[model samples]
Target: MKPALFYLIFFGILSGLLGCKKDHVENVPPGQDWTYDPTPFEIKAPASFPILNIPVGNPTTVEGVKLGRMLYYDPVLHSDSLRACASCHSQERSFTSDPPVLPHVNLAWNTSFLWNGKVEGALEDIMLFEVKEFFKTDLEKLQNHQDYPKLFYEAFGARTITHELCAKALSQFQRTLISGKSKYDRVLEGTNWVFLTDEELNGFDIFFTEKGDCFHCHGGILFTDNSFHNNALDASPEPARSAITSNPADVGKFKSPTLRNIELTGPYMHDGRYETLEEVVDFYSEGLKTSETVDPLMKSLHLGGKHLTTQEKSDLIAFLKSLTDTAFIADTALASPFH
Candidate 1:
């Protein structure tokens, strides 16, 4: 090679290296001051949902949300430190371990928590029990951990970590969990979307009409009235709400959980009795058992359920599967924050 050409190549390579260095992005710590121009959080409500209601005390913040996301996935919140809230309310199964539990959703508007609606408290308060009872969190590990103290300080302006701060951060993170980009949402949103299949449309009709009568309980944008009812699952489900409230009316009643991601959440019912959507559909179609405290909406009980045909049952199952949001469970943002 010519001397001049060799020199030119060397300089060109040096320039490329400089350019690459300049283009590389650097990791930076987020702003920490809780009061200084705090980052704001808001939701883009789906077509069916109204404005999301956030608690004034726990206004969402970027730092707080990040902290909450970390805490949510961190097993350090558990006694075993091998289990986290995500162990049960994981993303893959729509934030629920199995059928009976509903995936976490827009709880900013929720009036109750848990299966029986016995937990009547702010969304943040749920974490208090989760840490104490469900997860059996160890406060010593949290307080002594190198990263937790700093995270707690940034999120709550406290140098020391506490269960309340943990709950607050969790609540902040959970409130951001909004599912509205399903195929159905796109159909409602409009554009060049495929129309619902004939079977799905028929199932929708049955669900909304008196024949199916599903709309009354698990209806609306969130897919639940968020009310309690004796779904006629039993004369009384064990650890029954009746035991807690001493109200006979509360017997056999459980919170009508959201069906937003019903497809992924299966083994339906509080006891996870039915393993598949087929069994669940069949139950509503022909297997309505009479319970003393059955909700009035169970009008079909006097007869024998909707008596949906086999094809109709399949169609209804297809409609329920449409509620699954692949993007939601696959979102990296909702995954374990440790990585």
Candidate 2:
């Protein structure tokens, strides 16, 4: 074969291969050597849980999660240098600090975010808002950090640190915050010979059945429909989802948070009004206030509430407490890497 023709054919094939490559490779910094090999990670969930939908561009990886975990607990992301994603979300509380702050567990399946569902779409979408708008992350700070640049490069192969990369790393770590091993999960899986007490069993019945009328919004394996509701918290309460939808009918509507780890997720409700599970139960039992936008699922609203007996409330509280996963709270992986 002619030498000229051979060279032309080889170069054409090489260009084609480079063009066809899907994985993006970032430029390496001068005097620095780096490899873009990231260890793939699979998120673990219960058998009953649905498959987590990971974004094609951002696959979960060990390096990415490590960087993200550091970022989550580090105060570097905040302007004040004293707050972080973990400032409000602690692993011990199942990722929720108090009322108005929803748990970050099982968020891979969440279609919306925040108490009013202000942020919609995938986990990446919410993280984008959190990184760019909420956190106002200073890229220059990350770039100037002694360790972050190397960590970011190792995780994302990006020589430059941007909010997008930060958000992606944060999302990667948050996606691993799965919480499906509570006592309720054991009952479903029939593992460890774990069984609910009689009182808790009665509470479970009340929760799932119409007796307590709790299942309509808080049912399912996640213990939440991931939808907004009023639940008649007040007759003319402050606007909630309405702020997002701009619909008067959405007034007082708020996302029905997952009941998992409910024992530690209070002060209950969006306003942090109710301090204990007892108060939350009492409100649902006889303290309901009428509202035009109140959810239709609150069938007992007319009678003021579910009207559960005192013993039933105790039983229901027992069942709610059973949802707490002690293992999740103590998992060292979820704890602050700094500590």
Candidate 3:
């Protein structure tokens, strides 16, 4: 062969092998980096409740959060046009609906979120599911709408409402709904401006004491363990865990919600059985109905007998009120973008 041709052919063969080697290297799995930008809103998050793990595709951004806020308040997502995400998870109420009802008992309980606690999924997933449940519609159906496809294209670089974008937008918006600047937090941070009266101090003692024993499940900054437990409120011993795991031992278990804004997120419990803080204290104090699945932590609390003196109860309530962050409920950044 000619020297030039021979060199060309040799180099070409070597290049082919190098190309194959490069392709093989590329095929190897790369390490997964799940980090994303944290929510921009300011709040007093516990170290335990570390920045929520946002999915890789849907990162937190001011524009994306704005789009999510718009979607959250849009009534068109509902079948009846009467409800929006904000309708059920109102900002004023710490994103939970109040005044829960029991069908068989004709009883009204201070409810949190939907009638049942079944809606306690991830904020993004819940938003997507609500839309689907309302109209039996998915992103495909949404794409056929007059302006939805266009909106999606603008928000997510696509003309279709994929589950990824739906979840991302909603999650970004919900993350902005943090509420941490309460009077209680100020007291904890050693701000003398929030002066707790003697009654309030007494109530605080009771809350952490053996008589109240509320700290077991409601401990930590969020005031919830973020785990599920059965407090023995089952009427028929139905298996609650069957829905998720089909395990008999998991029956009647429910997630513990945060008590940051408990005053607004009332009719407490998974069923919204208690209406007031006093009623809730009384339940722990004197009204614990026993069952096989009762949480081991829930010993019968005397609440220092008589469910605390009236003054003590009032003080406890005052402490709970200190947990409410008025600034969070009125944050313009979280409000409907349309407004």
Candidate 4:
């Protein structure tokens, strides 16, 4: 069925399920009705996935995830109702902005948020910034929305519509965005998966070896060491990590995003300059910018790039595409619940 039709039907059934009569919790709040579901919010991930670093105060809950899913797709978060967090961070692109902007995959493991590591409080801090600073959401409208206030009440009983609730619910839903069904994952687990082509194998070797030297930062199940570095985007100073720290030594340093879905998350780099995977690979292969903060992994400052052959670059690109998780992007649970 078409996704829109499916979404409408699915949510129709969900609304019926949510309509079941239940004993309302006895909240002492004068005029507030409080209800909290005990449904466990199990994060679907492989057994090999690392332990989730969820904040103690904000454990995942069913109502929270439902509210968050709505908030994510709700254009009501923006004053003009023309954009949403999902307007930029779309599920089709693995919760990343369409610009090949840094994605929002596997963020429970991330210690910081955004392409720049400046925001250090919590993942909710990102929502606080996106709604308040970046997009300027009309909270009054959100509170007065047909369903948002009700959903917020369901998620956080007695708490009126606030940015904090928005962030918390959004964070709950985001933490559930686990992408471990890629071919790379299956192959690594020694499953009876499709065998890698020799070109892809060679590319993998190149990626891990000193020749490609990509593993240091982009390695493991998450595909990121989750650190800030100047990957030599340009020689001129760019407002990067330093914009947060104001440390001159941190100039041009930006957080290294995961390469899990690298195939689709282009144009590559902090500025979204490169348009294609070929351009990105070719840049790392021959167009490394010499910068004071350039990552030491780039190696041999005089040599602009990794200097991979054309065929090697092609193979590398193939290996990178292997990381794409078609199932993750198509997950109905992650789709817009409002549709």
Q: All candidates' TM-scores?
A: 0.85, 0.90, 0.72, 0.87
Better of 1 and 2 by TM-score: 2
Best by lDDT: 2
What C-alpha lDDT, on a 0 to 100 scale, does residue 268 get in candidate 2?
86
Instruction: Write candidate 2's Cα lDDT for 78-97 as tens digits.
Output: 86778999989988777888
Ranking by lDDT: 2, 4, 1, 3
Candidate 3 accuracy as lDDT = 0.61
Which pairs clash (backbone N, Cα, C closer than 3 Å) in model 3?
97-113, 99-111, 100-111, 110-266, 110-267, 111-267
What is the alpha-carbon lDDT for the whole of candidate 1? 0.78
lDDT of 4 by residue, 1-339 (tens): 899999999999887766643223233332345455536687777887888777887888898899898888888888788887788888888878656567978887887777778577667787677778777877889866766776777777735788777889889988888888888888888888577789889989988888898888897778898888888878785979988888888888888899988876777788788889898888888787787878787784579887889899999988998899999999999899875
Clashing residue pairs in candidate 2, if any? none
Question: How high a TM-score does candidate 4 get?
Answer: 0.87
TM-score of 2: 0.90
Runs in model 4 with CA error above 4 Å? 1-34
Alpha carbon lDDT at 295, candidate 4? 75
Which stretches of model 1 miss by more than 4 angstroms?
1-37, 235-239
Residue-level lDDT tens digits of model 1 in 121-144: 788767677766787777889888
Q: Poorest 10 consecutive residues of model 2 by lDDT?
A: 22-31
